[model samples]
Target: MLIEVEVCDVCRRLGVPVTSYTITETESGRSVVTVRCGEHAAPFEEVLGQPVEAVAAAETPKPRQAKKAATGRQPRGQRAERQVMTREQIDAAKAAGKA
Candidate 1:
C-alpha cells in the first residue's frame, strides 16, 4: 500500500501535532509543492494561491506467493508411476523364498 502525507506548517509553528494532508503545486513551473494539514489548507491556499491538484505516481502491486501443499504424500497421479506386484507375484516370490 502507498500513501502520500505531510505535516501542517501552522501546527508546527504552534507546537501542535498534525496528521494527513492535501498536496498541491503553488507555481506554474511546478517547482514549489505545498503539503499541509486540513485545518490550514484554506489559509495556506489563500496565501499561496488555490491548490493545483498534483498527480500521484502509480504504485505497482506486489506479486502473491504460492501456498505450499500440507500433505506428506505425493499426488495420486504421481504415485501411480511406481511399480507394484500382484497377489500371484507375491505368492510366487514367497514359494521361491525371495519374498
Candidate 2:
C-alpha cells in the first residue's frame, strides 16, 4: 500500500502539536487525513515507497521570552525633583563608614 503523509494543515498553520495522527481508510482506496491530536490509536500501515515513520513525536516547544536590559544609572531629570538627605542621616552614615 502506498500512502502520503504530510504535516496536517491545521497542525502546521494553527501551531497545534501533532503528537498523534488521525487517519481514515476511505472507500476510495486512499488514506485521508482527518485530524491530529495529542494521542491516537494505532493500526497504521507502513506504506511502500514512503518515508519512514517519524521516530520523534511532535510536541510544542516552550515559548522563550526575551531578557530585559540591566539598569544601574539614574535617569536624567531636575535636581529639585530629588529628595534631600538630612544632615544627621549623612553624619550617621559617615560615622559608620558604610557608604
Candidate 3:
C-alpha cells in the first residue's frame, strides 16, 4: 500500500512545496511533523524550538578588503570632519608628488 504524505504545513502556509521535513514529539506525547524545503527548514526549526543541525561544516569565506586608489590617496568624504582637505591643496600635493 502507498502512503500519501501531506506537504509541509509551514511551506504550504507560505505557498511552497514540501521537499524536506522533521518529525518531533511534544512533551505532551503529541507527534508533530513539519515539512519544508531545504531553504526554509532552518526557520522551521527555530519556530519548532529545535536546534537546527548543520548539513555540512563548511568554512566561511573571509571578507575581501577594499582596494586602495591608484594615486595612493585616501578617498574623499571618508576622512574625519576635523581633517578636511581642499581640492586645490590636494591637487598641489599631487603635482609636487608628495601625495
Candidate 4:
C-alpha cells in the first residue's frame, strides 16, 4: 500500500493539503515557495500588489472578426476605356473650331 504525504510549508500551520502554489525567486538567487489551499490561493496576489485576475484578463487576446473572401464578381459600375488621340486629329479638330 502507498500513502500520500502533504508537506506544504504554508498550509502546514493550518493542517491542510496544498492544492495550489506559487513559487517566486528574488534578485539575490533566493527562491520562495508558497503552498496553499484553493481558498487561500487568491491571497498570493498580495505579493505582487495587484489583482491577478485583472492582469490575466487584460493579457488575454480578444476574438477577431473573420475576413471576407473575394466573390470574383466585377463591381456594379461600368468599366471605362481610354481613347488615344493623335496630333493630326487634334489639329484638324482645332482648325475646324470643333475643339
Candidate 5:
C-alpha cells in the first residue's frame, strides 16, 4: 500500500531523508504542518513562530534509485561493397572527366 508520508521539511531541502523528528504547525493564516529532524524543531519554531506538537518516529525514506542502464547499442550494418575498378577503368574515368 502506498501511503502519503510527511518527510522532514528541513532535511528535504538538502535531499536527505530523516526518520526521527518533532512536528509543528506554521503560524500563519494558512496553517502548514512542517516536520523537522531532531535538531530542527527549535529552529522551525523560532523561524516560523510555531509551537511543537510532539516527537514521533517516521520511516526512513526508500533508497534513491540507481541510474538506468544504457539502452541497446546503436544499430550497425556492413559497408556497401565498392566497385572494383582496374587501372584502365580509372584512366577512362579520369579521361572522361577531362572531356
Candidate 6:
C-alpha cells in the first residue's frame, strides 16, 4: 500500500531517511506514521507536539505480472538435423538418375 503525506520540515532537516518511514491507517479512521531513526522509533500522534488531524492511508494498485516466454520447446542445439546433401552424394545421385 502507498501512503502519501507531507514530509515534516523537521524530519527533512534531520535528514531522516525516507525509506524507513511507514504509514498505516486504523479501523477508527486514524492514520499513523511510523518513523525509524537508527534504533529509535516513533509514531506521529501530534504535529509540533499538538494533537492534529488524522492522515489517511493511500492504497496502491496491484502491480501487473511480467510476461514470460513459454516453456517446453526444444532448444536450437537439440533440434533434429536439417537435410544437407554433400557434393559427392549429389553427384552420385545424379549419375544414378535418382537426383
Measured by lDDT, the strongest candidate is 4
The local distance difference test score of each candidate is 0.57, 0.49, 0.62, 0.65, 0.56, 0.53
RMSD of 1: 14.5
Residue 16, candidate 1: alpha-carbon lDDT? 41
Candidate 6 lDDT, tens digit per residue, 1-99? 996653343444354443345455556666655544432433442332443432321233568997554587665446666879999999999999998
Cand. 5 Cα-lDDT: 0.56
lDDT of 3 by residue, 1-99 (tens): 997765655555544556555465657676655567656686555555643343222234568998776586668657645767899999998999999
Tell me the spans in candidate 6 whose CA falls farther than 4 Å from its real position.
Answer: 1-18, 23-25, 42-99
Give candidate 1's error at residue 46 in angstroms: 7.6
Model 1 clash pairs are none
Ranking, TM-score, top scorer first: 4, 3, 5, 1, 2, 6
In model 3, pairs of residues that clash are: none
* Candidate 4 clashing pairs, residues 3+ apart or interchain: none
Task: Judge candidate 2 at residue 2 and give its lDDT.
Answer: 100
Writing each residue's lDDT as its tens digit, candidate 2 over 3-33 gives 7554444444344444444455556666655
Which should have the higher TM-score, number 2 or number 3? 3
In the order shown, what is each candidate's alpha-carbon RMSD? 14.5, 15.7, 10.4, 15.9, 18.0, 14.3
Estimate the TM-score of every prediction: 0.22, 0.20, 0.27, 0.30, 0.25, 0.19
Model 4 lowest lDDT segment of ten: 7-16
| Candidate with more favorable, higher lDDT: 1 or 4 | 4
Question: Over the stretch 1-99, how does candidate 5's per-residue lDDT look in tens digits?
Answer: 896665666665444444453344556545445566556666544544533332221223557987654466433453546889888988998999942
Clashes of each: 0, 0, 0, 0, 0, 0
Pick the TM-score winner: 4
Q: By lDDT, highest first, what's the ranking? A: 4, 3, 1, 5, 6, 2
